[model samples]
Target chain A: MPAIQVTNLHKNFQTKRKAVGLRGSLRSLVRAEYGTVEAVRGLSFAMDPGELLGFIGPNGAGKSTTIKILTGILFPSSGQATVLGFVPWKQRRQLAYQIGTVFGQRPQLWYHLPAIDTFSLFGKIFELDDRETSKRIAFLAEAFDIADLLETPVRKLSLGQRMRCEVAASLLHKPRLLLLDEPSIGLDVVAKQRIRDAIREMASLEGVGVLLTSHDAGDLEALCKRVIIINHGQIVYQDKVSALKRTFLTSKLVEVRYARQVAPDFHIAGTETLKVAKERYGVKLRFEARQTPVEAVMARLSEVGSVVDITISDPPLEEVIAAIYEQAERSEAAIAK
Target chain B: MNEYHPTRTPAWILLIMRELKFLLAVWKTNIASAMEYRAAFIAQMLGMILNNAVYFIFWVIFFDRFRDVRGWELSDMFLVFGVAASAFGLAAFLFGNAFYLSEIIARGRLDYYLSLPRPILLHTVASRSISSGLGDFTYGILSYLASGYCTWDGFGRFLCGVVLACMAFTSFMIIVHSLTFWLGNAAGFAGLALNAMVTFALYPVTLFEGFSKLILFTIVPAALMGALPAEFVRAFSWGALGKLFLGALLLLGLAVLVFHRGLRRYESGSAIQVEV
Candidate 1:
């Protein structure tokens, strides 16, 4: 059975429309207006056990709303969602015991207390016995290289150190499923690498199903094999990371450095030559793949001049995601028309 | 085959023990953190003591001008003030987060408690500990001792009063906290209402005759939290005690019902993470 099953889940919020100033406030007191916002609309997805899925979206793309519903933090207005064979919102207690959550922006550790104290608190919260709690804490602390910083207060620790502690705190119970929301936010390159490694190790070694959501493409690239894209309260696409790259990215930029400068009008059918720059002894050409493959582009470049160095790279994930959103917008408009 | 039955342990006892364990763990951390800022801790404690003393002085002067009002002596009024202040302080110290429910809800901090494997009220109250409430506790103990109200029977009555007072306070706090589910940011409104109750409650309810007394006793129930408990101390009446107990039970039931009902309409705030 799938570890998580969500079917047409929906959530809407009614917010009061209050005006400014004393007059408006008094006016509101007499008769206040309310506006309804549809946060999640008929969202449906399912994940198998031990699957590592990346839930990616823009700021208000309903990624967090979906996660909240899945984790039993918020109830859906309509439809059904079950995690581990139990209804999430109805069986929150049971779900909480089996799942762990790490919110990167919010360290679960009590700010005033040392990281170890927070770990111990979670231990008690989950009712883990002393022996098992200590063993797990020790193991995670060492793996995250936060053993030395265990005694340091959370407030005193740096963002990277606090993040490590937060991850350790979340795993003290050895939850069967882990939900990490922006676990690499506000961390340096080294810290991000460490977090990615830890997440990879946890999923592979412990067999814990992982759902990660982040704006950081590096985090998605490093830790997730499967990517799910959400836009405007809907999942537009979900597939293997490699497949997403290959399907969305049609053109790969191939920069070639020549031995001598040449004013070559590099005319290739089904391809646009974007730019040309002359170096002291070399020429560089930037092109977009209209119909030709990257290999063909490289071959054409080779024919044009002596290629000293060559590199081919696709557009950044940010651009690809933006293009996807634009494509979605255009399609919606077409359907409306 | 013999029928199997489950043993029935009192729910309050179980709740108390769970809360005690949770509080002890939280308190240890808070105290350690408090020690780090020794000067700030002392300053805050001193400020609270001074605040309470100012109020005590006002009562003293009022009683000096008019030795008795509504046939209640100045000393008796002092006793009421002492008990009410201490009880309020203790509740504030232990469950102060109840006062910040609106902010927590607005910021989505309540998501943590909602997601936890425990009652939302218990989790929210236990999330933090307030050290300033110690001042109220101190004054209460001192006033009970110095005012000659600490007789053997008075002690027993005071014990009962303390328990009932805590229950009443908890009910009030829960009711206020639950309002956040409906009135998104009702902290200021709730505070105003609670302050009004406390103000009237710390006085002798008998002073107000007829409908006013009924209003205090029933609608607001401030009189029961204060004057009624004080009356029990003066003399035990089964009828009066039963009335107070019944009132508490009813209010508690109502509060819990309202909270759960409002929870149905609770729209959690943005998923933006919050730090405690």
Candidate 2:
């Protein structure tokens, strides 16, 4: 049986709404308006124990909502979900003992205290006795490379350092399943790599299942084996990371600022210029990696002029998901015909 | 079925005992966090004491002008102030989040507690410390001592009264803040309710009558937190103890009920961005 089994899970939220202007405000004061939002709709999936699964999506996608529901912090509006054979929302506390979580935007560490204080508190909370707690803390400190930084207050730590501590703290009890929501949201490249390396090593060493969520496709590639991409409360794509790369992750978005402008219609073969700034000094372009080589593009770029700055990145997850959705609809139509 | 180990089915009492240890650890962390700047912690605690002292001085001047109001003398005022201050102080000191729990709920900070293996209500409230409240707690004991009512019996009564009042205050705040589950962002509403309770609780319940008195006893619960407890302290009556116990029990029950009921609708702000 799967470690997690979610079938036809749905969650809806009701949010109060008021219009602009005094008249709208006054009307709302007398009679309020509310609208329903489907935060997660008919989401169904299952994961094997110790699997490295990435739940990736853009902001406002259902990734975080689904993770929250799986952790038992959220009750689905309808349908069912079981994590480790326990109904999550119904047996939240029980389920919590087996699962660790890190919500990127939320700091579980006490900001004004040293990271060690929180680690100790979590030890007591998780029911590990003093000696075992200390031993576990020391081991985690070494694994996450956070030993030297434990004595300093959390607030004084860099974002990267703090996040390392945060992740380490979550693992203190050796939960079987780790639910991480955007754990690398704001880390620099070096920091992100460090976190990804440590997480991968831990998951392998502990045989821990990771249902990791992120907005960046890079995280999925770096740490996850299988990938599920969701958007607007629904899954748009799901497959092995290799399959996803070939089908949906092939395109790249490049933004460049040149030292000088040469021509208005400056172009490169095998690449589509999505936007050229009005001043002609900056440009945005896209090219399929299978079709255009990066070295060729760079050679052409150098031929044009000295470059000031350049960034190569994945297209927004929203854009990728939208494309997948459109392709799915077209394929369905063709099959019907 | 999944292959994970069945969750440990600890006895209920065992669960409570573990959670209490968790609570103590959290409280210790809160104080340690507050004491990070030792001088600031001292300043805040002392400032609160001085502030409470100045507020009490007004009563001194009042008694100087006129001796008593309806068998309410300066000493009785001391007992009442002692109970109310200590109750509010204890609630503020230990469960500091109770004062602004609505903000935490509204902002979806409760996710931190909900994800943990502890009782949600206890862990959330005890997460922070209002160091200044330490000063209020000290002033309360001092005030009770100065009331000339600090006999062993009086001290026991004072302790009882303060514990019940503290529970009432904390429970009341929890119930108000839990309304945010249904009503969007009830922070301002909770703040207003807290102010009403605190304001009325500081005054003598005998000062009001009839419908207003009914409101105080049932709705705002200011009389229950203040005057009733003070009366119980002045002279122990089974009737007074029953009333105090009953009031605290009712409020605590309602608080747990309302908060857990509201937990069903906790958005965690994850749904906010998904709004239509």
Candidate 3:
């Protein structure tokens, strides 16, 4: 059975529509108005055990809402979701024991206490035996290289150190599933690498299924094999991370630095003319399995001039996500038309 | 799968104990940190002691101006003040985080408790330990001793009164904290309501006539924490004691029910990214 299965999940929030200005506020108090905002709408997905899945979307796209339902934090207005054979909302306590969550914005550690104390408290909370607790703490502390910072107060630690401890605190229970919402946010490059490595190791070695959501595409590239894209409270796409890049993104930018100036009107079949400069020029060419391979782009650039240096790159993940959004808008418009 | 699953994990009991343990751990750390600023700790403790002593002095002066205005002696008033002050102080120390509920909930800090395998209310209440309660506990003991109401039977009654007062006050704090689920910005309102309740509680129920006393004793239950308990201590009346116990039970039940019902409305904020 899959570790998580969500079907037709929906959530709506009743928000007070307060008008601006003192007069408007007073009028509202006398006769208030409220409107229902649909936060999550008919979302559905499933994740196999031991799979690391990336959940991505713009702000208010219901990414967090779906995660909350899966983690047993919020009940869906309609539909059903089960994590590890337990209905997440109805069997929240059981689900909690089987899942660990790390929210980037909030550290679960008590600020005034040392990281070690929070770990110990979690140990007690999860009902871990003394030996198991010590073993897990030692392993995580060493893996995250936070053993030295364990005795220091959480407030005194750097953001990176605190995040490391936060991740460790969540994992002390050795849950089979780990839910991370932007765990790499606000971390420097080295810290992000460390966290990515730890996540990969957890999924591969311990067989822990991980469902991660991040605005950083690098996080998805580093740790996830499967990606699910959400937008406007709906799931637009779900597939292998590689397949997402292969399908939505069709072209790659080829930059060639020539020994001399290349003709400005340089053109090649199966490739669009992009830009040309004195020493370097770029071309956007469709990535085809046969004709327009990397070698073909390279050979064509060489034909233009002596290729002193060359590099090929796909468009940024953000651009791809934006294109997906634009495509969704176009499709909706077509449906309306 | 193993077939040896118990009805429940006995987790609720363990969760409560863990909360108590966390409270103690936090209390120790805060005290150590507080002691680092010894002058401030001593000054604050002294200031609080004097502040509480002034209330006792005010009541003594009131009695001096008019002896027994409402069929109550000066000692009876002191008993009421002492019980309410001690109970309020105890609640403040134990559930001080209740004051931060608005910020915690708004910032989605409550997500940690919700994700944990325990009752959110118990975890929230036990998240912190307040040391200022020691001062209130001392003041209560001193008031009970110095008021010359320390007969063997009176001593027993006062202890019982303290227990019931603690129960009622804790229930009151729970109700106030649970308001965050609905009000979202309940800290200031809770503080105002709590201050008014505490102030009104430190007076004789007889000082107010009919409806007002009934309101205090029932709806707010401030009078039960103070006047009724004090009345029982001064004179052993079965009826007053029964009323105090009954009020404590009702308040506790109502507080728990309100908290659970409100929890269903709790749309936990996302901690993935806070706006500010």
Which candidate has the top score in TM-score?
1
Clash tally, candidates in order = 0, 0, 0
Candidate 2: chain B TM-score equals 0.91
Best by DockQ: 1
True contacts kept of each: 0.44, 0.64, 0.39
- Order the numbered candidates by TM-score, best leading: 1, 3, 2
Among all windows of ten consecutive residues in candidate 1 chain A, which has the lowest summed lDDT?
A278-287
Candidate ordering by DockQ (highest first)? 1, 3, 2
In model 3, what are the clashing residue pairs, if there are any?
A: none
lDDT of each: 0.76, 0.88, 0.77
Once superposed on the true structure, which residue ranges of model 3 sit more than 4 Å away at CA?
A261-293, B1-43, B151-159, B235-238, B271-276
Give the DockQ of candidate 3. 0.38
Q: Give the worst 10-residue stretch by lDDT in candidate 3 chain B.
A: B267-276
TM-score of each: 0.91, 0.87, 0.89
Candidate 1: tens digits of C-alpha lDDT, residues B84-107? 767776776766676676677667
**Per-residue CA lDDT of candidate 1, range A1-337, in tens?**
9998889988887767888899888998899988988888888888889999898888788888888888788888899988989898888888898998887755678777688887877777777777888999999988788989999877789888888888878887888888888898889999888888987887898899999988777777888889988887887788999998888777666666777775757555545656667554343344556666667766777786787887677877878877877887788789899
